[model samples]
Target: MKFDFHSHILPGIDDGAKDIEESVKLLDDMAADGVDLVVATPHFYCMNMRIDRYLRHRNAAYEKLRPYLKPEHPRIILGGEILFDHSLVGNDKLPYLTMQNTDFLLLEMPYAKLDDQIIRGVEAIVEDRQVKVIIAHIERYLAFTSYKSLCELMNLDVLGQINAESLAHFGTRRNCFKLIEDGYVHIMGTDMHRIERGYASLGKGMDIIRKKFGNDILEEFERNGKMVLKNYSYEQIVG
Candidate 1:
């Protein structure tokens, strides 16, 4: 499946799409760009908000946007870009924040330096809770980590997600390609906000990858995305 594993397309939720119209428009662009599914990852901060309260807000926005989505539009899946914090470890309600109510969690780290507690917390979430963590837009956090630290995180068996925007605008093309080629980037997302910025760039960025590598690279992303969905369903069945 051609899946956008990270996105802020939900209306009035965080810094992505503003209203129903924008949400619909973003979905339209996604379909046109050949995206088969969109994981609607609105931002969720673990600092002060209760999980129940956040779900109420997110569900309400999702309900409002639900009516606008066409059947032909890329399928929408419920998830969140959870800003990682130590407090979230072993929280029973954390499962509700996972993708498709499954074990795959879209975890995001802040732009500052990574501390030991955060690393241990992620490990606990995976080992204790049986969750597979996909680090959101990991390229943004490179400055906070040394190459050794990055290798350590990858060694933990966590998947790294890169944004199409980062591939196109953030770093050198060679470095970005190196990340994907070296198996660091398991998936790519537009992380689109509005039509003005990344709506068009998703296709453009994917095209860059295709041109540099080949169709096989794009197919690898499609296969990896399917594994996420498949694993989600498998977790549900075993439970």
Candidate 2:
């Protein structure tokens, strides 16, 4: 299945789609991109809002678009793109932020250097919180993080999600491919925020993947994504 694993299509919860109408439009565009399923990962920051409040708002926003959902459009899944914070370590409620009932959490890192604190925090989230972390938009961090540092984070038994937008770019594509080649990246997403981009670029990125890597890589992505949607524990699939 073609899963647009990261997106901000939820209405008004974060700086994604603005309202129900906009959310529907984004979904429609996703359908055109041949996306089979979508994980509406609105931004979640520990410092900015309480998890409970964010959950409430996320549900409310999804509910607004639930009625308008059509068969042609990709099915929507609820998930959180949490901004990584050390306070989240050992938090019992971490699973609630995972891909709805799944053990995988999409965690976004800050734009600064990816270093010891960030790496250790990811370790704590996995070892302490007991949730698998999929680093959101792993390609974007190349601007700030050294390649060796990225390998350290990936070595912590966490997965990486590459944004389709990153692959569609000429400059970023090489590093994105390098991540895939090194086996750090395991999944893909549009990270679709606005209607103007991401959606179409998803198709473009996948096309690029197909041409350069072939169908087998796409199958790996689909298999991993399927396991995720079925609520398979990361250990069950990876370990």
Instruction: Write candidate 2's Cα lDDT for 1-239 as tens digits.
Output: 68988999998888889888888899888887788889999999999988899999999988888998888999888999999888898888888899986888999988889989989988988887478888998988889989998888888878889988787778899998899888888788988787755464577888898999998888888888888788676666565
TM-score leader? 2
Candidate 1 on 1-239: residue-level lDDT in tens? 57888898999988899999999999999988878888999999988688888888889999999988888788999889999887888887888888884688899986676766777778888777557788898777776876556666655668788788766764646567877877787788888888666474567778889988898888877777888877743233222
Q: Quick one: RMSD of model 1?
A: 3.2
Error of 1 at 224 (Å): 1.0
Give every collision pair in model 2: none
Q: What are the clash counts of all predictions, listed in order? A: 0, 0
- Give the whole-model CA lDDT for all candidates, comma-separated: 0.80, 0.86
The local distance difference test score of model 2 is 0.86
For each candidate, give its TM-score against the true structure: 0.90, 0.95
Candidate 2 stretches greater than 4 Å from native: 198-200
Error of 1 at 108 (Å): 0.1
